[model samples]
Every structure is written in C-alpha cells, then in structure tokens.
Target chain A: MNLYEYEAKRIFEAGGIPVPPAVRITKPEELAKVHFGYPLTLKCQVMSGGRGKAGGIKFAKDLEEGKALAKDLLQLVIKGSKTESLLVEPMVSIAKELYLAVTLDRERGCPIFIASAEGGIEIESSHNVLTEPIPFPYHPYVGRNLAAKLGLKGAVMAKVADLANKLYKVFESKDLDLAEINPLVITKGDDVLALDGKIIINDDSIGRQPAFKGWMEAHLVDMSPRERRAKMTDLNLVELDGNIGILCNGAGLTMATMDMVKAFGGQPGNFLDAGGGSDQKKTLAALELVNENPAVDVILLNILGGITACDEVAGALVEFMKKYPERQMVVRLRGNNQDVAEKMLAASGLKLYPDLEEAVKEAVSRSKNATKKPALAAKA
Target chain B: MILVDKHTKVVVQGATGKMGAAHTKRMLDYGTNIVAGVTPGKGGEKIHNVPVFDTVMEAVKTTGATCSVIFVPPYLALDAGYEALDAGISLLVLITEGIPPQDTAKLAAAVKAKGAKLIGPNCPGIITPGQSLIGILPGSIFKSGPVGMVSKSGTLTYEIALALTESGYGQSTCVGTGGDPIKGLDYQEVLSMFEHDPATEVIVMIGEIGGNAEEEAAAFIKKNVKKPVIGYIAGQTAPPGKRMGHAGAIISGGKGTAESKLEAFKANGVRVAMTPGEVAKQVAEAIKQPAKA
Candidate 1:
C-alpha cells in the first residue's frame, strides 16, 4: 500500500532518519496548536506524486497565513486524489538537495539502492544516479560505497553513508517495496534531512506487520463502501468507469476478459477476480457486487474453471438470478464439470455461451440495449 | 525430452487438505506416480490411497521422492519450501498464492544457493502433457506434440493450450512459470531447455505487462535459441499504476509496460501475436516451416 508523505515521514523519523519537524492538520482550526510557527511549508497529503506542481503546497508567514493555507490545501486535489490533511513544517535552508531510495529490483529478485547527487522530480532521469544491489541483512560497506560514488567526503559523507545504512534497515524490516527520501537536503551546517518521504509497504506482507495492519484499516476509510466490502471478501476488485460488469476466476483470465470487453466496444464497470476455487458463497458475493452497481446494465461472468468447478458456480448463478430477476447475466462456463453446468443453467431457463467472443459481443449489445431502459434503484 | 515422465516419483505437501487431495486424485488419474503424501500431524493417514507422512524428510527418506508440490497456506509456505529443500527434494512446486514477497525473496535465494529450483510460491504447478500432470491445470486441454509452452499465467496457459489443441497443434510440455514477481524458472531458463530438448520444435511464450522477463527472454532467443518462438502478451488494456489481480502486473516508474515488452519482442526478432487465438495460429504456421536461426 502507498503511504502519504506525512505517514511515510512518521516511519522515517522512527527509523532514526532526520526529517524536518512537522505537525499534521486536518482542518484550518487545528493549526492553532502548531507553535513551531511562521514561514511554514503546508504540504497537502495526497497519495499521488507531483503534488507541488499540482498546487498542493503553499507557504505561510503567520498564524492567519498558516490557517488560510491549511484551509485551501485541505480543499485541493492533486491528480485524482483529494487532500486528506496537511503537513505543516518550518521551511529550512538547503545547501544541496540529493535523492536516495531503497527499493526492490524485481528483475534481480533483490533490493537495490538508487541515489543521485541531484534531487527532485527530475532525479528519475538524472544520469548522476548510482544503483547498487544489496544483499540480505544489508552489508554496511555497501552504504559507504554508495556515498563514495556520490562524490562526497568528510563528515557530510559519513552522515550520508550512515543514513543510507539506517534507511535500508527500515526497508527490510517493514517489508517495504520502496523507502524513498527524495530531495534529501543538506543544510549549510552539513546536517542532512529528508525533505520528502515516500514508502510503499508490500501488500502481501500485511499479515506479518502489525503497525501496517492499522495503517491499512485507516486507508480503507476513504474508499467507497463497495470497495471496502470487496476488500473484506478477498475479492480483487477495481472500480472502472463503465456499464458492463466483468467477473472471472484467475488473475490472468480476469484481465483477459476485461481486455475482451474493451475490444468489443463495451466499457467494463469493474474488474473483479473471484480467484481459483471460488465456491458458491464467493461466487454469489461477486455477482452481488456487480449487480448492485446501478450503472452496470449487464454482468459478464467468464469462468474457465480448472480448480473452480463449473457446476458449483452455475448453481450460484441460478440462485442469484432468482433474487435479482431483472438483472442481465452473460455466462460462459467451461472447464471441469462443464456438461453438468450446462445442464444446470438450462434447467433454470438460462443459457450459456459456448465461445468467449460470442458471449462478450452479446453482453456488449445487451448493455447497449439496456441503456434505453430506465436504471432501476439498487435493491436497498 | 519433457522434464518429467510417467516414472518420476512425486509427493504432495499438505496432501490431507481439500485441494491437495483433489488434485492428487486428478494427477493419479493422469498416471503420475505420486508415491507419498506429507501433512504435519496427519501422518499414518492416507489420501487417495497414498500414504501420508508428517515430515518432508521422512517422506523423502521413505519414498526417495525428488519432487514435491506444496499446497500449504500462505503463512507456512516458507517453512514448507525450506523443509522440502532441506530434505533433498530438488524440484519444488509451490502452489499457494498470497505468500509475502519477503518470504518468497528468502525462498528464491535459498533455492538458488542450494542449486535447486523452485517453480512458484504463488503459482500453478508445471505439467508434461499425457506423461505427468502436476498442479491445478486441466490436463484435457493439452496433448503431446512438438510445441513447448511457458507462461506467466495459469488460465491463460489453459486458454491458449486449448486453442493450440483445437488447431491440431499439441504441446510437448507446458509450464505455467507463475505470475509472481520472482519465479523459480523464468522465460530465458525455460527457453534454453526447450531449445536443447528434441521433443520441442516451436516455442510459445505467454507474458503480461509487468517486469522485464519477456524482454529478457526475447534477448535470449535472439542470441541463443534456434527454435521458432511465438510470443503473446496480455494486459494491453490495463491501466498504468493500478494493480491487476496479479501483483507483478502493475506498471510503475515507466517500467513493465505492455507496449515496451511488445516492442522488445519485435526488436529481438521474436514473432508477436496480438491475441490468444493468433498465438495458436502462428505456432502452427511456424512449425510447418523449418527452425529459424
């Protein structure tokens, strides 16, 4: 899960990395207690990057200025993400701005450190960057080696090297995909500070990290209720803007189905993977998630069951059809127990498509047809 | 030659569970010699008439089984994999999903260090058609032929294999390399084996949007492979930065894009198929012609 800057800063501070002291303000009125005061940088807390260019940052010289900045930033939106709060910090003078990050290099199947003498948004394209692969347990000399490559020496060099060592410890311990301190600033006095922080915890490792589990709970508070329910149900769901709801068994098949829906000129309302071996209850939950979306006129369920039995899913479809008779379903069930599934669907006065293309095209046309009819209220 | 034939002895981990027992029966029906089962605290029991043991070392000692397919829950996957590896099971097929990447990283390194190979920590197992069936793939979709297949996906493996079968082009061996970020065997490693194996004539690579696996494979084929390679990439429609069901399918930092992978394949002289059906047709056509340099 991606962490907002303020959240990431908390992790950085706890890890012994130096960051500018900051206070979090959810509203303009909350700024009264922030006594560090004057000429503070008010950074809107949004998940997406390029927050500065997107007008999510402002400066304030006094209490009234800070309050006004907070109010404006709390109402601002960066990219597609709205501001949840503001991080208020006393602006600092910088002698030099550098960048560094410890992230998993998927190709190498290990973690790597990326550092640059020049920091900021353009650091990604900077030729001055140095990358070094880190072995497990993080050998200490690797940090010193990276700092040496950055062309630094003396006390400042030692500090940068020490910071790199500590940063990687957090990366490994937190099970993070990335722990980045972009624009890590060097003061005139040679003190280093992480001006911006970005961290992404590995979602699959949430069970092992107690602190992140709490973060995930707070993370869900901003999501739509349907999305929250999907999370609790173990359904891999993404809300897409469209009219046709698509459900499939495996990750690859689900994506392939979504591509097919788009190929046939039908927009998919959502992408939901029921996963392999989904039984009756999970199948019914998946169907209800899509069927309840009032914008979704048709749900196209494509199950190429290998572990998931075709007949079991067909039974769920029959039960769901009984409850929501008005909803349209385009079903293509195949693989294990397909013959029994075919017969089961036929007995319920429903039909199954034999081919993927035919089923997708039929759903697209049915969705187009349904747009002419009034959208019924989702069953309360 | 195919990796495993009828005589290769196999043991099922977590064999007393519902999935392990069901697939064990399916594999047994396909004539795979599943000699023993392993489930902690379930020793002395039998699944599908196969004897069960509590520890992997005990099972290996008794049956001399060199291969193990795991079905343990996600949290216990690391322990299960290590147990099998320590017990001298050289080939490990991890069938559980949702294994934390950290555990997988540790497992991947351990497997490498031991000079053994792990197929997946979150993937469907491998299969050689009509000879031996392992993991959750439907054996009916495959038939023995000159084509060797490797894919990052499970169902896409079945979908394309079915298409190949329907078109009268069967497979010599098909391996679902697993969609996770780090797999035991990648496209390049599998391609080398297929290139050397006499049974495989044409190669089909199924890749998705994420990672440099496809690009790396294409580079390998351009240099080392003499066999005709046909590539099919999924997720042309997937939005960037959004996590698809597969964790590895996310595109970030201007990397792992479908267009970039497709371009790499084309630049390296690998044949690209836009859709699943096209993959089968291209493979059939490639086989009719002689092998390319």
Candidate 2:
C-alpha cells in the first residue's frame, strides 16, 4: 500500500501542495525529453526507504550527466527493492527543511500530525517536534497553531499552515494511513515546496480508494513469484526461509504454528493463511503454493474449522497428498465437520492427528528426518 | 464479567447466511437465549428457532434484544454496526472481518459518541464461558472458571482456550478484539474491565504485532490493572512490513516488534508467555502466587 515518491507527489500536487518541478521517466532514454535544467535530481521510485543514502539518488549537471544518472538510478536496487522508474526534478535551492506527517496513532485512537522544524530522517532523533491531534471539522486555525508552535509567523507561517491543510485534505480524502511531506523546504525564492514525500494507503480502504481498487496486484513490487501467485489466488502468504511449509486457516494459528516450529527445532518455510472458508480448490491452490518451495521438507496443514468445514480441507489433502505419495503431510482438523473429515481421511488411507502439539511434534521430526543430515546453524 | 451473560437477549445479524445460521444453531444448542435475528429481506423466518426480523431496529424493538452479533459481509459491516447501535443495542459484537479500517474508525467514533460498546468487526465476538455463547467459538472447548481472556485473533484464541481447558484452567470470558487495524475494544480497555470484574481473577491478553495496542496495554497494566495479566504475542518470526495474514499483524518501521512488545510487557508488571502452551502454564503460576503490584 506504499506509494512511490512520484505517485505521492502527484497526489500532493492535486491536493494543492507545491512540489518541485519533476518529470517521471521509466527509461534512461526518456531523460532527453525532460526539460528540467542542470543540477537535476534523479530519485529512484522504490518503496524502500533510505534510497538516498543507498545511492538511489544522484545529481546531474547537464543532459549528458542526467542520462548517466538516470541510467544508474533506474538500475539501482535499495534493500532488495529494484528501481523501475525515476523522478527527475530540478534541485531547488532551499533555506530550510521541515518535517510534517499525518498518521493514525492507535494508542491515541485518532489521526495526529507530527511536525518539526528539522526535517529528514534525522527527525527520528530530534526532540523539537510538535504533535497536534487533529480536531474534527479540521479548521485552518489548527494548522496555524501548529506552524506557530514551531516558532513561525507572518507570511511564512501562513504558507506553511496552508501546506499542512492541503496535505491533510489529501490524507483524509484518500483514507490514507500515512501522508508525509518530508523536507517541506522553504526555497531561496520564498516558495514552499515539498522536496520529497511518502504516502501509504490503508490496505483495507483500497476498495473505497478508487485509485487503488485493484492497484495492489497490478503494481506489486518486491514480491516473489509464489507471493504474486498467492495474491492472484486471494490467499495470504508470506514466504520464509525455512524447511517446513505451514498452512493454516487463520493468521494467528499460522504464526503460532511457525513459532511452534521454531520451538521444536524446526523452521517454517512460509506463512500461509488459507482463509476462513477453505474449500477443495482453495485448499489445493494453497497446498500447491506451499509445496512450491523446493526446500520445504514437510507440509503441515492446520485447520480449526470455525467458519470452514474440515471435510473440504481433508478432501483436498487426501487428493494432493496422494499425488506426491512420498511427500510428508501432516494435518490437524478440529471443529465443524471434523468427524466427517476424520472419516474421509481414514478411508483414503491418510492418518489424522487430533492434538495440535502431537501433530506439530510429528511434523517437525518428520521434516528433520527428510533432510537426513543435520548441520549446525552458524551464529552470525 | 463485562460480557453478555445468560439473561442477555441477543440478535444475530445476517441470520440467514451460512456462518450466522451455523453459529446461531451452535449457540442455541449451547442454551444461549437468542431472542431474534435480522437478515434484511429474510423477515418472518426463523433461524435455529429464533425469530427473524427485517432490520436491527425492528429486531431490537420486537424482541427486546439489547445485544447483537453480526456475521454480515465485510463491506456492509459499517451499516450493520450503525443500525445495531442506533437501535439501542448497547453491546455490538461484529463477527465479520475485512471491513475497511476507515469505516471501522468511523463506526468506533460513532460507538463512542452514542455511549455504546463495540467489539470486533473481524473478530470471533465474545463468549462468557458457561453463561452465554454470543460468538463463533465452540462452546464445548470453554468451561466456567476464574480466568478472563482477550485476544486479537480468532483461531489462536481457540487454540489457547483448548490448551487451558485441557490443563484444568477454565475461563471467565474470552473476547476477540479482532485482528483488524481499527477495532472497537482493545487490550487496554478490556484489561481494565477484567481487572475490576470480581469474577475475572487473572487476565490473558493475546496480542499481535503491528500497532501499539500491546504497548498501551502494558502501560495500562503498570498503572491500573491489579490482576495478573499474562501476555502472549503471535508472529514472532514475522518479518518487518509483511502483513502476516492479519491486517494488524505486521511489524512496521521497527515499531510493534515482538521484541519491543515483550520488552514492554516485562518492563511493566505483566507476565509474558512466549507460546500458547506457555500462556496456559503462566496462568497456573500466576494463580498460585498473588501478583505483586
């Protein structure tokens, strides 16, 4: 749900906030058409933070230098997220940098703005910040008070407050989880411009946020193939580097399964939530996704049938496990229609374990045995 | 116990749906006095022998139902919640998941404005063991005891409750705050309720990583809660920024980390349990020794 800087700036611009003149380009060859003057700023459009410090951003003095920098920025990778596009901007001469962000504070039970005169990542350690809890029917005075609290006055204060208001309108209108205008710079020419920005759309609100109704799957970044496949299948999956594949009906159970795997001296290959109602096809798809990991020594399917019928999951297990008869599969089915599932699995010549601890213990040991050779885990 | 007890009349929203109808039968079979159900168009019908009404207002008015548990689809959860709240249902437990957080936020704000209490929109609802079963939880797994429970997860709550029942530790009430980012009630509020309830001798809070709810609960326990609060956080192995099944189970920006939550709980007066089994064991130890304030 994190938007790249280019996308965020687009929203910021529509919200009436001033952003430095910029042109977005996907290819280095497109840099020739951009009319931004010398000393251009080339920023990689990646979701990862600290891209600037990671050399994802560079300065270009001319068209020749811009092409070179554009090529480098587009090819750069920061924290495993590859750069696919670049935001080419004319580096503005600024007198000061300020930090301003609006985010939901779960502890406070409302959205609040965190503003500071000092901007950039250094604000993490800076203490000179003012936190203004957003009042309902947001007034201009709230932003003005915040600007004044930061020791601002006159036309500069008025402009900064206006920036805060516009930024907040975008935040509230978009149902954003976070809207940040980091380094809201005061230019040498007495203009306030957003040098950089970040916006994270709330995942749940994507359905209402018209711009991203189906945006997640379309612009998925830093996702493995299996992950993308799972997304397309409407399954919740997070791939892990482990030996045992874990599939469960709920997030809590899946995570607890992973924790128990670690506790029992085994590692879980992935965290997959097959969802509340797991029928035959969904179960089969989930099994296939979990089994996609070649290093996965064993697959454990845990279903506490609160909203799901165990028989469907059991049916899928019986069929999928039969295909790979040599592969190790463990299942713990309880709750609704569990008795039926138990009978179905019994008829298929598949064993079913009722106890979670017993099932997990057996699966861990079986996975350990599948590898055959145990190597010492090196301490980093 | 701050939960719907035996005498509380309850209505099931989306009563004609598969999940609602199923849980209604289960709850009725467990002896819960479900007064009525509301399914919009499915009026004058009966679900598990409970009268069905067209709307929440009519259901509340006709049956005198003061509490409602919803199983409607995620998108319509807000309207369902508002209907229940506007109809004078003081306690609204939403069983549906995947409602937009902004909608939940607005629902929560309205719930507060109306002076009503709301539970999960993505949760399993609430259960007062041996008293009332107004949720999707299997009634047999829980028993009447002194332990009170609050969780951010549905299945994990079931797993731990089963573990507790097997270990001879029955529960007073187990409430799911739902795993969504914005829920009606949280650990801090639920903890304070448990602390004041004489029936609830010990409180068990199951938290997920993502938000600062656990940290806030830790601070609350440090100051207000006197009961022994046992905490177990799921998703210890969850990587940063990856949503671990639950929307609220992600660790973002080094905050809401398992390590940070565990540390916060330990630094405060709360006893932390690493796993589900350990949580049950911790409650046993907590009961034996009077918790030090």
**For each candidate, what TM-score against the reference?**
0.94, 0.93
The C-alpha stretches of model 2 lying farther than 4 A from their native spots are: A372-380, B41-49, B267-269, B285-293
In the range B167-219, model 1's lDDT, one tens digit per residue, is: 89989888887878866878888899999999999999999888888889888
Model 2, CA-based lDDT? 0.86
Query: How many backbone clashes does every candidate have?
Result: 0, 0
Tell me how each candidate scores on DockQ against the true complex: 0.67, 0.66
A18-63 per-residue lDDT for model 2 (tens digits): 9988899998888887786777888898988888789988888888
TM-score of 2: 0.93
lDDT of 2 by residue, B181-289 (tens): 7779878778888888888888899988888888888988999988898999898878898999988788876888888888899999889898888988998998898
Report model 2's chain A TM-score: 0.93
Write one digit per residue (lDDT tens) for candidate 1, span A95-165.
99999999877898877899999987566668888889887656889999999999999999999999999
Lowest-lDDT window of 10 residues in candidate 1 chain A?
A371-380
